[model samples]
Target: MAEEQLVTFGLGTEEFGVDIMLVQEIIRIPPITRVPKAPDYVEGVINLRGNVIPVVSLRTRFGMERVEESDLSRIIVLQVQNKVFGIRVDAVTEVLRLDTESIEPPPPVALGMDSHFIRGVGKIGERLLILLNLDNIMGGEINHESA
Candidate 1:
């Protein structure tokens, strides 16, 4: 069976995983500059080195109530479709490998937010992880908004 490496993180009580290949780097939350007229899920832009990247709040994206950032809060920088962005997560749990056979398609019902954001559901022992479709998370609209 083929195995996929995943970077797991927490959002509220639920856990989510994203393909490690998509992850550029993980860093502590930095000062975010809010964008005018931008989507509510977008926390804002941040300066990493010299490049500016928009940061999306996974909580807001999932329709979950916002919480104050804790020490565990982090931003996972990802590159999807050649556009770089960051996703603010409650806390990063751990990096793990999941067997492809243990994955299932997203459920018919929405998982909190939109169903399209989910790639699949992965099972690891007693845990259920919501795999994310990074492409759909921002889609093409975000690029236009940020530009």
Candidate 2:
């Protein structure tokens, strides 16, 4: 029975997970410099120890209502395809391991989020975690809505 370690975080009322290996570090929200002409989901860039990493708002990416950042807010730094970026999340819940058998393909609707962003659904007891598909997150063929 192979198990996958995941880092779970909160967005709105739902929970999401990403492979722990992809996570570089988690930090509290830092002062972000807004970038003009960036995508709506792209909140801005942050200076992390001299590294200018772009930050994405998970709420905006999921088309959810934006809320004020609280003490629980965190920025999860992830490395995908040799690129490093940060995702601003409401709160980080916990890290856990789940058996691969517990994961299922994304449903048709995928809880209202674009199915493109979901890799699969993992079930743990009564909790359902939406595993993120990092491949489609950045530098992929993206469709921007007309404002």
Q: How many residue pairs clash in each candidate?
A: 0, 0
The TM-score of candidate 2 is 0.93
In model 2, the worst 10-residue window by lDDT is: 138-147
On residues 21-136, what C-alpha lDDT tens digit does candidate 2 reach at each position?
Answer: 99999999999999999989899999999999999998998889999999999999998767899999999999999999999999998888889899999999999999999767
| lDDT of candidate 1 over 26-80, digit per residue (tens) | 9999999999989888889999999999999988888899999999999999998
What are the runs in model 2 whose C-alpha is more than 4 Å off? Answer: 139-147
Per-candidate TM-score against the hidden true structure:
0.94, 0.93
Cα lDDT of all candidates, in order? 0.91, 0.91
**Each model's RMSD to truth, in Å?**
3.3, 4.6
Poorly placed runs, candidate 1 (over 4 Å)? 142-147
- Candidate 2 contains a number of clashing pairs equal to 0
